[model samples]
Target: MLRLPGFRVASPTTIAEAVAALAEPGARPIAGGTDLLPNLKHRLGAPTVLVQLSRLPLRDVEVRAGALCIGAGAVLADLAEHPLVRAHAPSLARAAGLVAGPTLRNLGTLGGNLHLDTRCRYVNQTPLWREALGGCLKSHGDRCHVVPGGQTCVAALSSDCAPALVALDATLTLHGPAGARTVALADYYCADGTAHTGRAAGELATEIRVPLAPGPRRETYVKWTVRKSIDFPLISIAMRFDLADDAVAAPIVAARVVVGALASTPKLVRKLDALRGQRLDDPATADAIAAQVGAQCKPLPNLPYDADYRRAVLPVHVRRGIAALVAAGENHG
Candidate 1:
């Protein structure tokens, strides 16, 4: 049986205290403990102290001028069902509801999902199993098993909500010993698997702010995993575009296409100018856009799905997300 390392729990009552406690050596902040607890059991993470943020009043959901502010500690289940989220950011709600099962969603938080760790076939194993393989690049022992001769770890980031948030043009608030600084959600993750998030040590993500701007915004998230219920995303896609009206191609004021679960960070597809002012009136153009977005995804053999299958599903998921957005445009947009 896998056993978790002994660790002390540091319960902090405020955001200030939470960041202060996280400044200690071997300390890690845990909210849901859904992902962290399992990592602890596998001995993948062994922090000496767990600085719990449960007591903090960071679960408030507010609607400000042209933006929605969601506290970090807000539960995934609540976020999924919240009226405001369902209205303003249905894609975000869908992404949250799709993470794991109902029980996990009840415990999971938006912050935890944003800061979810990178996962690999070789690294996310029991201690004995990992030791048997001489450890992978993420464990800092040797080369990456996923991509031989690779200079860096290629562990796949399995965060289902990250892509949705990034596509929504969200901003994150992080508090640490150096005080608070806001970062764009797209800029929060690094490509390196070993230290995926660019967040500094002792930092605690406080909230997520999504702008309700450009008017008539349309967004949708779609994911395909090995299992329909609780499994992490194998190929998750979220597409956001601002349309002039419910028309298919209506002038796109802003657009973002993101692919997750295939790389250390959700990839924001470049060369998206083709989507601007171009209506989806022609199927060939839509297919071309999907192909262009899929071309940016870099899938590795780090997850359960075969690399080829993973790659093949990205465009399909993107197409589905766009279709969903088109269908829901009249209602929200």
Candidate 2:
């Protein structure tokens, strides 16, 4: 049986009180406790204090001033089923629905998913197993076994929400003892896997603000994993496109093709510039554009799948996304 390391747990009713608790040395703020509890059970993390954010008023989802404001404590199921999310950001809604199982989705908060810990097969083992192997960089050792001679950790970022948020150009507000500040969703993640978050240690995510699209834009999220449900994605893609006319054109305006589960952070493939002004109905054009997209992705070998498999499937996902966007555009027209 895995035992959680000893710690003091505090549940605060207000955000201010929670922030104050987190400001204490060796204290960590937990929302949903999905990620932190597992880590604690495996002895991968040992904090002197665990500050729970469940009582904080951070569970609302509403539209305000042309933007969707989702509180950090909002459950994944709530975000997945929210009418605003379905209408405004269907990609995010789809992604949220595809995360874990119904039970987990009901308990896991959006903030917890956003701040999910980086993972690796070698790192997510029992303490005894890790200790027996002399440990990995993300665990107790100084050297990374995954990269051999590499000094930095190479754990894969397995969150399903990151790519969807990045594709939507969402903004996040973080609160702490020093007050609060907002940042672009892209800035939330660091390139390094071991230290993925750029937020201050004592800070907590307050809300996620996603701007409503002008006109009618279409979005979709597709995840390729070994299992249909209750498993992490092997390669997940979220594509958001602002359609113009029957075909995409200039000021086709904004598009984001984000690839997740293949790296330390969800990668943005900006080469999507090739698809601009291209008609999605033309299979030749779509195939050519997808080829270009596949060329830009560089998948590393990790997790349960091979790098080649992930790379090969990249174009297929892009092609399907374009098809969905075109279908949505036609329906709207």
Candidate 3:
């Protein structure tokens, strides 16, 4: 049986107490424990203490400053069904509903999902499995087996809420001993898989605010996984488009396309400077954009599915996302 290593759980009623607890050495913050517990059982991260976040008052979902402010501890199910989220950012709702299973969704918090760890085939294994192979770059090895002397870990992060939130122009507020600071959600990511989200050692996210886009905006979130439910996505796409008109071939006034689960950091495609204002309804245009998108992603053999298969599916996902958004926008108009 897989057993969690010896650890203590500290429940704090206030955010300051929780932050102080996490500041201790060998201490980690856990909200839903859906992802952290599994890793603990596998001996991947052996922190001596877990600072519980449920007792803190970080579970509210409300509107503030013309944006939907979501506490980090808010459960996925509630967030998915929140009236403000559904009305202002349906893509976030769609992504939240699609997370794992109904049970996990009820238990997992938005903060937990946003800060989920990166996964690699070599690292996410039993101790025995890792011992037999001398592990890999993310675990105990000197070289990355996937890249053969690659300098950095190539784990893939498959968080569903991250991409959708990024597409929505979200901002995250992190609290620690120093105080609280709000930054763009996009700024929370780093290039390294090992340090996927840029939450510092002593800091934890307290809340997120997603600004409402102007009218005539459409968004979509799509997840490609082996199973329909209770499975991590092999790849996921979250997209947003502001349309100039409801007519076919209408130009995109502004756009953001974020691809997740394919790399360490959810990748933001910003090469669309020339492509913006281009008609999104054109199949050929989408294909060309998809082709360009596919060229930028560098998939590695870190996921359960084959790397080549994941690589080949990028364009299909992009095409599908574009088609879905276009249709939805037209209907909205």
Candidate that would win on lDDT = 3
Q: How many pairs of residues collide in model 2?
A: 0
lDDT of 3 by residue, 56-125 (tens): 9999888888898999999999988888888888899989999999999998999999998988888788
Candidate 1 versus the native: TM-score? Answer: 0.95
- Global lDDT of each candidate: 0.84, 0.81, 0.85
Write down the RMSD of all candidates, one decimal each: 1.6, 2.3, 1.7
Model 2 regions lying over 4 Å from their true place: 245-251, 327-333
Q: Considering TM-score, where higher is better, how would the candidates rank from best to worst?
A: 1, 3, 2
Local distance difference test, candidate 3: 0.85
lDDT tens digits, residue span 215-278, model 2: 6566788888788888888878887777664344324545677888866888887666765655
Off by over 4 Å in 1: none
Model 1 lDDT, residue 301, Cα: 85
Looking at candidate 2, what is the lDDT of residue 330? 48
Look at candidate 3 and give me any clashing residue pairs.
Answer: none
Q: Which digits, one per residue and each the tens of the lDDT, describe model 1 over residues 1-333?
A: 656789999999988899889999999999998999998898887798999987899999989878899999999999999998988888899899999999999999999998888999888887888888888778848787888888888788898889999999899999988889999998988979989997887999998999875667677788887779999888888878777775655777667888888769898888888767766544665587688876778678899779888778778777766666566546652
Per-candidate clashes come to 1, 0, 0
Q: For each candidate, give its TM-score against the true structure.
A: 0.95, 0.93, 0.95
How far residue 210's Cα lies from its native spot in candidate 2, in Å, is: 0.5
> Candidate 3, which ten residues in sequence have the lowest lDDT sum?
324-333
